[model samples]
Target chain A: MTELEFDYLRAYLKQRSGLALTPEKRYLVESRLTPVCRRFGLATLRDLVGTLKVARDSAIEKAVVEAMTTNETFFFRDRTPFDLFRDVLLPQAMARRAGQRRLRIWCAAASTGQEPYSLAILLQEAGVKLAGWQVEIVATDLSTEVIEKGKLGLYSHFEVQRGLPVQWLLKYFTQIGEQWQIAPSLRSMVDYRPLNLLNGFEALGTFDVIYCRNVLIYFDTPTKADILGRLADRLGPEGALLLGAAETVIGLTDRLSPNPQHRGLYGVAAPVVRAASPVAPPVSQLRVAAR
Target chain B: MTNDPAETRTCLVVDDSAVIRKVARRIIETLGFAVTEAEDGSDALLRCAEAMPDVILLDWNMPNVDGYAFLQALRQRPGGTGPKILFCTTENDVGAIARALRAGADEYIMKPFDRDILTAKLEQVGVVQADAA
Candidate 1:
């Protein structure tokens, strides 16, 4: 890919998906788009870009973004988050919501449903602890392919072994052949849908707990902070936000602050600033504000 | 028959071929779950009656009670919860996958699967939440 072509592709990804690809990502762009080129029978990246120029929602457009968006994930991925979730966050959230008796969670970048299903199993393990509370988990990903897979709640034998314990394996999953599937009740606990975090997902309603992990690393600083700001607006007063272990609320936005008791967890600070710019108001636009 | 959480969970591997059983057995045991082998569907059913494994890696086209037949019968067993059944097939036919789903199979696997494929399918079926605990 020429410098000129790389520049255009970078701009296209930003405009179309709010992803900011740095100059170092030149090889990444080439490798990701190479397959798309072969599939469309285009000889060069330039030709692929040319085809994308004409139509919105073109097949090429979808394929390009799907290729760029990383879908790597597994059940309970990092141990800390799930541990905090079941042992500390969940029980506390349950207690805090006892008066209302309802809970809603959103898993941004849900990939193929491992994260959400993991949450379901925890809730299931809690059993009677959640006796009367109504619960809903919304798992969203930019890739329709993974979203569809998430809906099926199927994983290869490999997926089940990673981070998932044998006990949960027995309790929550049933073997089909060489693959395993989430139990019907657990699968139904989550609603997986096509969502791009850049589009802003507040329309799904405020959530008590939002797990948006390992997704912020893809964007530039402005996009990262902007997404964090929008996420702040979506948290219920009693809610907490769980980010990837490597992620932080520090310096991103004044609306969310690091929780004293948790390393990677953030909570809404009082007097939510709601992004200093016109997020598009009542709340200003969720899109990044002009500098 | 065991309810002890610390007791290694059981995986009943049913395949007529001794070689496939050995290969699957090594992988499943390495996964830390106890492995039981059955040469065909009849043996598999008898083993299952004695104990409902956490996960069952079933093979289609077995003698006497085939994978589909075992699946249909297994689902009908009166119980608290039946074992999660994953039907293994040598064919990559879409029709076969659809049939497995219809037969109340929890998931499916193809022949010559390695540790990764088996692990992923097991996680998908929830017989193992390696990430959760």
Candidate 2:
């Protein structure tokens, strides 16, 4: 594809999905969009870009966003985060929310439902202390296709093996031939939704813990700033945010601060300055090296 | 199957990855040994306390405890009848493998392994008799 075509698609995608694509990622667009072009009967990515430029159809735009979004994930990825959730986050959250008798968590960009289901299993293992409390876990992704897969909770042998524990697998998953389907008890605990992070999140409501891990690296500075602002607004006062080990809110937004207790974990901080301020010193900035 | 009683060894499989467990189970079963599995080091130690296997296939990377901790725990157990352990892991750095062997791994296997190589290693360890082939 020509630079003009790449720029056109990048600009369109940025405007639609808030995902920034740089020149180095031009090949990524070509490779991913080539299939879309073929499916649409367009000769090439350039042709597809040309058609998309004038196409006012919402379906076409949706398809572009879906094609552009990367939804790579597997069960129990990077075990430490889940350990932190079970050992530190959940216990503390449970104690603080004891009065409310309810808790809410959102796994933003939850690809294929692994993270949310893993969280549900952790809570189930915690037992009756959580029984009386109303618990809801909402898992969302920009790709409708991946969201469907997440709801289905079916995984191939290789996919399930990535980080899942055998005991949990034998207990919560049933193997049918080479594929394993997560049991209904675990599947029913999470509500999967198709959500574009750039869009309004008003309907999703506030959450006590929001996991937006390993996702923001694709976005440019401005998009990250906007998404962080929206995420901060949607967090409860004492709520927490979990980012990818390499991600941070430092120099980006002051609405959230790094949680000292857990690496790659952040908490909603009180507004440091009025919204009108261009930038405020981040309450705390710590870069968690990837394990 | 081997008629030699010494070849009828027990093996424990410790890995957090379900895929690895499934593959290891098939390999160990084919070698004519009873296999038990644990997800992490802590769980493996608990299993070890109940039944001491003749050999263990341990993965290096795991959460809530790891292969090194499990090895140490095994040595600390009373009676000193600890099973021989082979570190079957993806950590292929020569120095790391040497360190693991020094730390008490009887053998080391790399990831994306050939079944023939694994079987040869098992035979070398006397867990599987050559006649079993």
Candidate 3:
């Protein structure tokens, strides 16, 4: 692939998805897109880029974007986040939303559904606390292929073995030939949708908890700030956001702040000026802001 | 399991395959454990009788007292229940996994595992810290 073709593909991917590919990642684009070129019967990366420039084939464009997006995820990946959800998030959500008896979680960039399905298993385990509660897990990813796979809830032996606890595997999955299929109940618990983080999410409604882990590290600084601000808008008043262990909001955006009690947990940041003020706001102003 | 002044944890890797034992040993040792290798379940049992390990990575199918039989016997021995047993096998059947769990295996590991899978399994069973992995 020439420099021009690489640049076009990089910009195309950035616009379609929020993947900010660095110059060093040129090889990654070439390697990942070579198979895509072959799959589409194109001769080389140059030919693929030429076709994408015309924008004639939506299928090829979709394939190129999907090829560039990383879908690395596992059941209960980075166990601490899941532990925090069960031990901290659930109890807090229960106490704050007892009147509503409803909890909605959004797993943004939910590659192959492992993250959301893991949460479903936890919710199942919390049967007593969540009794009679209306629970919903909205799982979305940039790749439609992964979303479809997630909807099927089928995983290979190797896939199931990664980070999934043995008891949960035996309890929640049925072995068919060599692959394991997650229980239908758990599969149904998550509503999988193909979504690009660059696009709007107001249609999905607000969420009590949003898991946008690992996906933010791929975006540029401005994109990270934009996404973080939008994510804060989607969060309910008492909602919490969990990012990947390696990610942080310190340099990204002021819309969300880290939960002091927990390291990886984040929530919407209060307005800096108002929060710092010594005097209390009037009840009328507070009620108006609530609306 | 006995610890030296350094307090390194002990792990017993039991497998008929020398390659797997070596790989597991290399991975476990990085997690601050002194790893010992045995060819099969009978040899593993002898190792346990001499001095118990903190964790055992037991192969399911082996000659002369298979993993299941050895696990049953181990649980019955004095201070046998002290070690965390992780049943490692190619068997992906739920019934087989449930059987192993019932036989007192603390966790399960599928065959052809890499360092990450081994580390994750060890962390799940509390044999290794998450940060250490």
Candidate 4:
């Protein structure tokens, strides 16, 4: 692909999906988009890009976004996080929110629903007190196609076998022909939506825990800061943020701070205020005066 | 008489993938034995508890509880109605197969299996009769 075409595709993808493709990712673009070019009956990728530039059709743009969005996920991916959630996070959240009769979690970039469903299965294993709590999990992805597939809750045999625990699989999925359909009870727990992080997110509402793992590496630094800021704004006072083990926001944002108890886990830090207060007398002076 | 496929010995196919389980079920049924399925080792163990099978076609990989763990647990069960297990998986390292056999696997079959090969192997393990239809 020509530099101009690469720039056009990259810029369009940056605008549509929050992913900022680097120069090294050129091959990825070529391999992934070649079929798109063929499907559009364009002679070349350049021709496809040219058509996309003037294409007024929403379907074409949707197709481009869908193709660009990465849907890399497996059941119970990166075992440690799920282990921490079960062993540490959920218990902490439950204890802290004991007074409230509800809990809300958001899996941003849920990517075919593995992460959220994993959480649901964990919650189910944790037992019945959770049943009384009004739990609502919102799973969002940039790709409408992936979101629809997540809602369908059907996975090919190999897909479910990847990281899914056997007992949970037998309990939560039913074999329909060659596909495993997630049980209705577990499927009902998650609400999936198509959300572009580049756009405004006031409509998403606040969440107690936001899992935006393995997504920030795709964006530019500025985009990462912007997305994290928005995520912070949507986080409740005591809400926590979980990222991929390789991802961190330590220097990226002042809005979130690393949780002292857990690595790669962040919490919405209390905002700084510059309001002035009259200084109290020194402790030594007070002791002398009392004498 | 011992090799007769008409003996109708039950076999449990344990795999997290519905597709693999279905394929294994079809192959096992074609070999003239009844088949049951479990998505993981834990479920497989529970099913074994309810009704002990004559043989188990166990996948080597699964999330949460895996194949090796299930095999160990199965061997630990008392009263010794122990099912003869065949390791069915994609990992075909000869050393791995040897280790599985050491761990009490009666046979090992690599995945993307041929139906005829599986039937012949089952017959060799004495789980089915070679001539019984």
Candidate 5:
């Protein structure tokens, strides 16, 4: 690809999905989009771009975005975030929502459903502890194909082998053909939807817990800040936002700050009123890490 | 399978190689399981007879009774249904994995796995940390 072509492609990706690709990532673009070009029966990279440019094609655009997005994920990935979820987050959220007895969780960019399903299993295990509490999980991803897969809840042996322990499998999955299908009860807990981070999130409503991990790294700094700002707007006063360990809110946005007691966990900017959520460590006692 | 919470679950590691046993022992111990070593199938059967293990990491190829034969014999013993058997070997073929599963193995792991893979396998077969839930 020529410099002008590369620039066009980079600008196109940024405009379409808020993905930031530099000149150095030209090789990555070529590798990821080559198969898309072939699949669409286009002769070359420039031909694909020309085809995209001539008309407003939603189908081709969807295919292109899906091809570019990294859908790599697994159940209970990285472990610590889950540890915090089970131990700290859930209990705190439970306390805050105790009177109302209603709690909602959103797993944004929930690739292929593993992260959300993992949360369902954890919540299910604590069924006795959470009795009479209205609980719901909303899992969303940018790719429609992945959303369909997430809805199916079917996993290969290799997928099951990744992070899922046998106890949960035996309790929750029944072997159908070669794959293990997640139990119907667990599947019913989540509502999977196709979501684009660049679009409006008005329908998502407020969430008590939002997992926007790992996805922010793909966007440019401004987009990241914008997304974080919108996410903060959607958080309930006592709600918690969990980010990828590699991600932080320091320079990106002033709307969020890390929770002192919890690492890689954030709270909405402004003075947190310690009126409802018992799980939140007192705001006055928050130990802010120096940027 | 032991319902007693106080009982530390035991894991019998059966392999001919010392290095493999040491590696398996360290990983199993990290999961809070009591580790027992047996050089081969015969020794493993003997150790299992004295006190049943909750989980077994059996090698496919070993002297003094191969894995399949020992598994067949062990399944006939009382309380044999309790322990979850995992065949850990260099067998990467589907036929070997199917064979092990048919011979009463609960899980199968190919050689050259890491700590995460080992833990996940153990967890998949229900060797979960009590507090992790």
Candidate 6:
């Protein structure tokens, strides 16, 4: 592809998906979009760009954006966030929302539903604490393809092996042929939607906990700050936000602040009484839980 | 798999397929394990008798003393239950997987696994440190 064509593609991707592709990523653009070209019956990147220049085919554009985005994910990925959810976040929510009896969680970049499903399993394990409570897990991703897959709640044997505890596997998923299907009860817990973070989420209302992990790293600093600011807007007064292990709110936005006690946890930049904070379970108990 | 006395953790890769065993050994070794290889369940039992490994990657459908029998035999032994057993096979049936778990297998691993998958399973079974992976 010519430099001009690459520039146009880069600008288009940035505008549509907030993907800030550097000049060196021209090869990545070619490799990822090449399949989209074939799928859309375009002969080459030149033809694809030509189509984009003219009145664009919505399907082709969607394919291009989805191709550029990576959806690599698995259940209970990174491990610690889930632990924090069980050990800290849940107890806090239980105490804070005891009167309301409602808890809402938003997974901003919930790729293929694992993050939300894992959270749902934890809620299921929470048992009596959440017995009659109304819980809503809103899982959103940019790709409609993944959203459809997430709705099905089916996973391969290989996919389930990643980061999923064996006992949880047996309890939460039923094997079908060569794949496993999430339990219908757990599958119903999450409401999956296709959402671009650059767009508005005001209609979805506020959330008690927001997980916008790993997705921000692809965006430029401005885009990251904008998304973080909006995420903070969606969070409740005492709600929590968890980022990817490598991501943080510092230097990006002042709307959210890091919890001194937690590593990747963030919340609205205010001094809120953490009266509901519970002691983390013993290390031995966590080790046993991992098994 | 080689017995490296200097290595603190030991893993026995038991598979009839040399390729699978070799692949699993290479992957497990990276997780700070001294790997040892056994072709079938009988051979694995002998290896366990010599010096029980901290982890066993057992394969089903072996030539003699298949994985299920080996698991049953191992659990019956005095120090057999000490080693964390990960049942590895191409069998994807739900019944079979539950059976293995019931037979004292610590975890289950599907075939065609890579380094990441092996590491995840090992971490799940506590053979490798979770953060270490």
lDDT of 2 by residue, A171-289 (tens): 68877665779999888889998888888898889988899998998888988988999999888888889998789999999888998777789888865564685664554532333
Model 3 — TM-score against the truth?
0.94
Write the residue-wise lDDT of candidate 2 on B27-101 in tens digits: 888777888999999999988888888888899889998998888778878833457677777654445656777
lDDT of 6 by residue, A51-148 (tens): 99896589988999999998989998988889899999989988999999999999999889899999999999999879999999999999999999
DockQ of every predicted complex? 0.06, 0.04, 0.73, 0.04, 0.22, 0.57
Alpha carbon lDDT at A101, candidate 4: 64
Each model's Cα RMSD? 12.1, 14.9, 6.3, 13.5, 9.7, 11.5
lDDT for A174 (candidate 6): 87
Candidate number with greatest TM-score: 3
TM-score of each: 0.66, 0.68, 0.94, 0.69, 0.74, 0.92
Expressed as tens digits, the lDDT of each residue in A184-265 for candidate 1 is: 9998889888988888676899998999999998888888999999999989887889998678878889989889887779
Off by over 4 Å in 2: A273-291, B1-133
- Error at B86, model 1, angstroms: 22
lDDT string, candidate 6, B1-133, tens digits = 2234475788898999998988888888777788899999999999999999999999988998999999899989989989999998888787788899999999988887888888888878776765786
* Docking level for model 3: medium
TM-score of chain B of each: 0.89, 0.89, 0.94, 0.89, 0.92, 0.93
Model 5, TM vs. native: 0.74
Candidate 2 has an lDDT of 0.80
The model with the greater lDDT, 2 or 3, is 3
Worst 10 residues of 3 chain A by lDDT: A271-280
Please provide TM-scores computed only on chain A for all of the candidate models, following their numbering.
Answer: 0.90, 0.90, 0.93, 0.91, 0.90, 0.92
DockQ of 3: 0.73
Model 5: per-residue Cα lDDT over A172-288, one tens digit each: 887776677898988999999998899889789999999998999999898999999999988999789999878999998888989998788998889656687567666665655
Pitting candidate 4 against candidate 6, the one with the higher lDDT is 6
